[model samples]
Target: MSRLGSFAGDKMKTRGRKVRGSAYLAVPFVLLAFVATASTAFAATESTSKTAIFARVTWKVVKPGDAVDFDLQITNGARLGEDPVTYDLKILDLPEGWQEKFFYQGEQVKSLTLKPGESLTVTVEILTAPNSSTGIYQLTFMAYSWMAEYASTQSLSVELREPIREINLVATFPGIVAQVGETVQHSIVIQNRGESGESLRLSALAPEGWSTRFITQDKSEVSSVYLAAGQSITLALETETTDNATPGGYTLTVRASSEDGVVNALMELMIALREKENVSDFDFVSRFPEVTAEAGKSLTYPITLRNLSANDQEIILSVVTAPEKWKTAFKSGDTEVTRITLNPSQSLDLIFQATPPSEVSVGDYSIVVEAESGSTVKQVVFKAKVVGLYKLDVQPSTLYTSVTAGNPLTTTVKVTNSGLSPVTTLSIQVTAPSGWDVSFSPARALSLDPKDSYSFTVTVVPPSNTVAGDYLISVKALSDQYVSDEVQLRVTVEAPTSWALAGVVVAVIAVSLLIFIFKKFSRR
Candidate 1:
């Protein structure tokens, strides 16, 4: 060995061994690779350390075409003094016509800002389309960070349930306007919103004793009907109120039922009477509408006149019409006046006096009282019944008479007029039993004054074939101006006088002859 090699070896043994040139270059490359790996790990850690944002409930059940709410909570998770962060709320991949809104404290918000370690709660409302299919749908609620331009998403599961049976009833006129004792008809539209057909029965509930009917579009009456899916039908609802029904508002709850469910709709009916003020601006009322009086007597009526107009009015009182020979006058406050001034909603009482003629007939009479305002006139009719002051009677002197068969008998009938007025055209009427003929001697009618009387001869005849018995006869005196008077009598029928006398003679002769024969036999 050389002296230099030996010295280098000693140095190598004393110190560490020397590196090659390529190995030195590879050291810098290894350090660069380590730095790149550490950077990648830091970025992965940052990405995983996201803010806490999640829904209160992961899934919910809802009905199609219905609104649902999702409660969401976000917690800052950042260290204190970190920069304020802004996030935008949105719904990702939403179906067309679907609505999604973010609400903060009952108000909708588009974006939210939070400081470090701060927390926020928001409500998310989602509305599905009317025609949406039924199934489980996954929807994403995204919160995009403005600083990082990164989106954080939470999943919400919505389960939609389709309706089995649904019906909607609509009316063009929900309220019916009518008068008392009137029938009102209205059209209603029925729409089936379910996916299947339904058989629905229609019925109405209202005040007791009210009549209601359902008529279809073709005017046919039906108790129940069939409807197709998504079909619409129009029907008329007729309501008839009683004549004595009061005036007010009536509520009707109409219901349509199927095997699945029942649906109800409300209808308001407004009923009012034909008010006297509606015809005219004034009204006339009487305490008593009808009166009974004797013939030739005067009658007085009290009436109240009301001003129903919005403004004051001057009413002219007059008599529209009355019976012939009747004089009518109106008096107010001890003075005969035909004019009155009344304030709005004010009323005045007046007297209506009428004098009837002395020769007036006994019957019903009507008087009309009229009130006239500017361009308006109102009239009221009052009824008066007149009764007679006298009476008529028919009497018979002898009620019964004995008559032979095939013979006639006559009886006297007295007809008297007891009324204060004369009775004219008095005629006689007779009614007898079977197999008997009855008539009046004077077949014509006669007139009788008050307190006067007339006698009539009534003849009765029994047929030959009639058995000996008692029969009833009725006699009546009829008058044109008064009631008829009636009287009843009885007739007894007997055998002929000639036959009865012959029987008595034959009995006497037989007894005498028997005595003579007995004496002759004893003498022999």
Candidate 2:
């Protein structure tokens, strides 16, 4: 019985050892499972923390009365398969009386929702008061997500500066001339040289009995204009004088002002007035009473005619006296007319053309133009001084020649005066191929009278290495008062004599060598 009990105790001990071994093996598995679970929880916490707000530009400089904008982005870092998050937007520490608005996709919104791994862009616009003091301002913007229990905040700074408000008024023409009972127009430009735009009221102060108004490019009359920052506009200022207006210098003041009177611009313009002359029964006026031109060229005189009578009159026009063999006519804009009808206070512009004969002498000639209306007659005298014509001709002895390379060529050219005028200080110029030398004898002529001719000797030499080809040489005659057309001469160049002789010698030597070789080989 003692032996059986000892055996049972040993069996109990073996069973206990087996159970302890199983427990040791299971410990590592449990540890690995716990580690994996904790790691997953940490990853989730890290992803959620990435949900935040970001701003591209948090600081800016702006002028008072200006609007400032900040670009912002809201991101959701929730993992895929996660629910969307909604955020409430708010602005803190903003100045009093300042206006602020939040916009998403160009629409004002107080809150926005973003999907997992999604981002949304938003804008905040702030406007300061016109009279705001110049200083640095700070403001905070927040986006709160209740579901995530997170608040993302961004601080923005803005420096406000003094406002610039300037307007410039300028008159294109500060002075004008006009007669009594007449209206004149001037151009003026309005420019805004400020940081902001404004609506300006325009006014003009003129003398008594004179009216003024501004006209736009579209011809619409306007008393006010709107100008944008750094922009300008042009307008016409028209002034009308009364019938009884006196003849004197008058000053006009033009003004442009804003509604609050903070911005103003003033410009002054001067107007000169002259007295009206009494009207005559018949009037004839000529701006040009005398003219000088070549004998073959025509002369023109501009004449103005007015009839002050209270009735319509039939007028006759004619050239009563002129130089011999000269043709004169009255033209009203390319149409020939000898008679015309004029109403009271009406005027007509006439072109009187006088053409002299080609052989007319160089002297002053008198012309009388007459206009008759019943018993009324008006006459105007004009003078014409005729200068002789000018013409030049150039002639060459030959049009073509041939020469060997490195040889000289000789030719003769004649310059003639074909017209009535005398040509003086006449010279010759030659243009030839490259690497060629040219010269002229008796380089200049003192004078060449009408129908007179002068001869010049021309020499040309080509370079030794000149190519054997056909080339051209141009000769022209020039005077202080005239230039003649260019005359072209063609020249042919031949190879040098030595080159031909050497070629022949080479041929002979080749033939002799072939004969010797044939005779020597036959002996074998």
Candidate 3:
């Protein structure tokens, strides 16, 4: 055997040593004899009265209704004897509602054994009752052995604190069903059960593009709220789902937190896809629903004329209502078509051209086009805006004419306002070659409304001594608002018949006189 095992065996043998029968019978006589000498012997054993044992606790404070554990070290530091000693573990002066237990290693044990030059470590578990008072407590922990007639005591300080304050969170609806792209609203109840007020912060976690909001009792938004002790508040939560969110189950979490603790609730959202509506049959729509063009201008718009009925049909297209004097036509490609045949679900890209009259007002105007198939007719309206045109035109009644050199000739001159607005302060202007005079009847300026014409008499006179020839003159209407083109008027100037007659008479007289003079000269 090993030396340590042999030494332990020897100690066990010594403890089991048997006394002889005579020695055991004399126990009473020896005890009576020792009583007579006890006073003298007690003095010799007085120094051994102090046991060589020490104990210490590891920690101090614990909260009410909570379990606290501490390490306990017991040491037999003195060489009292050669035998192993057993010490009973105990606690004294404990609080009334508190319970204590001693454990050797991990098991509950009442006592522990230690040899000379040895120490033992154990755990002391203390449980505070739910109703324990909050205060500092002094506890005495003792390790004693009855057989050894020795004991050791250690003092410990333990504190019991008030129980923890708790808050509760309850959601009215934990799950909701919603349509895709819909907003969902729910409520949550937050209650404070503690004796003191608490400030709690609110937050939400959701997928991207989801929006959430928190509203209080007064319909005000806030990130946090203050709740008094034993008070409850209902919070409103509004959530918006995205358009592309899948039609399935999704989880959303909302949290309420404070400095003391945090709590959260889960919400399940089920989304359903919305249904689509069917399009109407037999529809006519313009590619460009609205158009802008100047007066007297033509604009063509492509229209999708569809026959959504489930059969072949013939449709006659015509213009029903339009701006006055505005011409409209329906054409397929480059050919004008009044009627067409379409199969089921057939559509034709027809070009619709509208020409607004030059006299049309400068504003938005609507044109309605009708399509007739059997007894059914569909009319589609389109908008056309006539913008202003700053233009004027001048035309002469007679561009070319004959005139006597000294006599005056008259012709009609027409001034037209081709613009959309009225032309005010209009005056006629005439340009003629040198030695020619031209004049208008109403020489002052006049006002003309859009697409309106003003007629004036133009008088032309050639210089009396002017040589007969062809001449040209230009006439134009001028105004601050409009100016007409310089229309050219041709005039052929001829000498007067009286001037021809006088020329002939003078010629005859000269000839007769010359004949007489020639006769006299011949006779001489």
Best by TM-score: 2
lDDT of 1 by residue, 382-500 (tens): 89888766567888879878899889888888888877667778877888887678888676456887778888888888987778888888887888777665677988889787777
**TM-score to native of every candidate shown:** 0.31, 0.44, 0.36
**Full candidate order by TM-score, most accurate first:** 2, 3, 1
lDDT of 1: 0.75
Residue 325 shift from truth in candidate 3, angstroms:
8.0
Of the candidates shown, which would achieve the greatest lDDT relative to the real structure? 2
Question: What TM value does model 3 have?
Answer: 0.36
lDDT of 3: 0.73
Clashes of each: 1, 0, 0
Q: For candidate 3, list the clashing residue pairs, or say none.
A: none
* Local distance difference test values of all predictions, in order: 0.75, 0.82, 0.73
Rank the candidate models, highest lDDT first. 2, 1, 3
lDDT of 2 at 241: 85
Report the lDDT of model 2 for residue 399: 92
Q: Point out the higher-scoring one by TM-score: 1 or 3.
A: 3
Go through the candidates in order and give the C-alpha RMSD of each one to the true structure. 30.3, 21.5, 30.6
lDDT of 3 by residue, 52-151 (tens): 4344554466666888777767776557586777887767556666778889878999888888667777888888777766655555566756532345
